[model samples]
Target: MTETGESGGRKYDPAATHNFPDERLNAILPDLLSDPEITTYLEAQNVNAVTRKGYNDHGTKHVEIVRNRALNLYDLLKGGDVGFNGAIDQDLDEADEPVIIALAATLHDIGHVVHRDEHVYYSIPLAADLLDRLLPEFGFYDASEAVRMKAEVLHAILCHHTEEDPLTTEAGVIRVADALDMERGRSRIPYEKGGRGINTLSSQAIESVSLRPGDGSPVLVEIEMVNAAGVYQVDNLLKAKLDGSGLENHIRIVAVNTKAEDRLVERIEL
Candidate 1:
């Protein structure tokens, strides 16, 4: 499946996956691949059925998903005025920062290739190791800079699951983008090998997502869902995702399509 946004007709395929905006990534991939340990681990990630359902475990799909999703979120944030007011504006263009964000988002789920219980826990270390091993190849001054980048990437990758961690704008953007797609697709894929129905059943397709600024409190985001199934899914899973993505207290489900008639039901916020 291709990920395309309304703004740019750009779609990423595995065919030419390395057209990075920054050249720093070019220097890094070779070193990353040079380490047989990482290669071996990444290679063995496909044996599990659950891993097969995710975007990036064993194939190029995950990377493409990450890149497209990350870019899409950036676009949305900029459109929503969040970029100008948020840290993304400050850090997006810093040398290789976009690549760092894109790469982390792309690689964050590799641990799921092993186990789902704590994918973040495993993926972060792997990312750090890969970055360190590839530092020389990437032409970093020394292992120190590589380690710093690794730390930053790890911060973004690991914290994508929860907001408690130090959130760089790139990380926050990746987390939200990674999550928004759960409703767009992948919900029909079975979560377990022997799962009966759609393992990742979707709650709804969001018709709109809007944010309201507050005086002293946190930002408020209102989400509108497409159907009752969407409602069920949001209440059960997506809400947690919102909270985890650092929008829990800030985001609210304002309306839904209850009749399945594809007509939006509006609720007044009191």
Candidate 2:
């Protein structure tokens, strides 16, 4: 929360909060935001009815959700007693990795501007363009950091949908948050109306979301749905992917009973 410039922007020392420096991340955000192709991608989805809900899925909302979700995941890791697992050292703080997680969360859905079906594909190229633009801004002035940023962002974007993708520490955290999104905070009207089948629409009606920490294992993600349209439809689509995620052993989704139980409903879990 230190401001260094005239614009009053943050002057974060990456080591102050994370292992990576602020210069490294600040160097890349604009690049990620500047690509003409990415701009086009954002513009396309900016108009989608599903994206307009509650000021939570729009421009700032996108990054806001990402930041919150990433931080939450980090906190869950620490609280669940797993933060020190993997490459994490006893003396090192995991919070330092937040910048990478936050940035990835911010950019992961940029591909959604093109299409929602596996936006991860669009995320990769868009991330590359963003890194190209970011290098000069961060005083990298050299190619080394530029290359590093590209690799980092690409890893983050590709792995956000599935945990099987190879990833750095930051990428792994962002991936968990992205998967936990579960359409939890999104509006159901537009999605329910336009979806072709029951599964697609049900998948759209997420109401409550939470993260459960695992003991040196994959995090468990809990999503509660209102199930306004059809429960089974949403469950089938999300379950397959969640199960496929390496987190199947640790990820547990608990669907609570609600009044709108009008479809092929399971009694316990979604």
Candidate 3:
């Protein structure tokens, strides 16, 4: 269960269950990671999925993974001079980009409380109310600024699904980040209970996914699989999520088989 990567010449555990480290995040949104409302909502979402829907883990763990990965993509692209939709247009401050991305990534799946299909649209209002209450606690007391931030966060949540196009850099990052939560542990619960089909099998084949700086691109998404069949998760699920995302040009995805001497399975770049 150990996954590793390097950033700024330092080693980090990608599979670690703790919050991702970011100094700016601590200054701007110090209360978000431990917010009671967010924690309660995530717990309820997991109960709904496991008790009623028979789905895999889409709770706090999934959201945290998305949050970390989305922020990683955002920072990499921003460092490489990629312009964010809100920042480039003067709608959101550059410093606020990570906050919005993290909020959107963390709350995107809360709508499963209502239903699974079209949960993206349902998530908008749910996340908006939560943001309205939570933003001011973090010093976003200005009315107009809070309203604008809420709108942007909702947009990112709505666009995390493939049916919707992510118009902003943050939203695009959230979309791809959501898809990267395909490690086998994510589906182990349902798979062991006789979960069948491509979704479960593809997830089971994924051994690990790592995000790091790339040589040719701004970010590299390296996926290691126990079987070549895991390519279905990358090609069908992850690729669909990244195709319409605005961050595609800044990313390069490579999948390899760990059981096959690290043989290259699939490589995609746009």
State which candidate has the highest TM-score: 3
For each candidate in turn, the TM-score is 0.61, 0.61, 0.87
* Inter-residue clash pairs, candidate 2: 18-96, 19-96, 31-130, 32-130, 199-233, 203-234
For model 2, how does the per-residue alpha-carbon lDDT over 1-270 read when each residue is reduced to its tens digit? 232332112222334443323454455456654656555655565444245431224333444455556655554554444332222321222332554565566677776666566667876887677667754555643576446555665776787675445335556566555544445334334444564444345545555555545444445555555655434533554464445444344445666535454444433463
Clashes of each: 4, 6, 0
Q: Arrange candidates, best TM-score first.
A: 3, 1, 2
Q: How high is the lDDT of residue 86 in model 1?
A: 25
**Which of the two candidates, 1 or 3, achieves a greater lDDT against the reference?**
3
Query: Where does model 1 exceed 4 Å of error?
Result: 1-46, 49-63, 75-93, 140-142, 163-166, 183-185, 191-199, 203-226, 233-236, 244-270
- Global lDDT scores for all candidate models: 0.50, 0.51, 0.76
Candidate 1 — worst ten consecutive residues by lDDT sum?
83-92
CA error at residue 47 for candidate 1, angstroms? 3.6
For residues 57-172, could you state the per-residue lDDT of candidate 3 as single tens digits? 88877877777677767667766777777643546566677778878987999998888767777788899889889888787447877888888888889899988898888889
Best by lDDT: 3
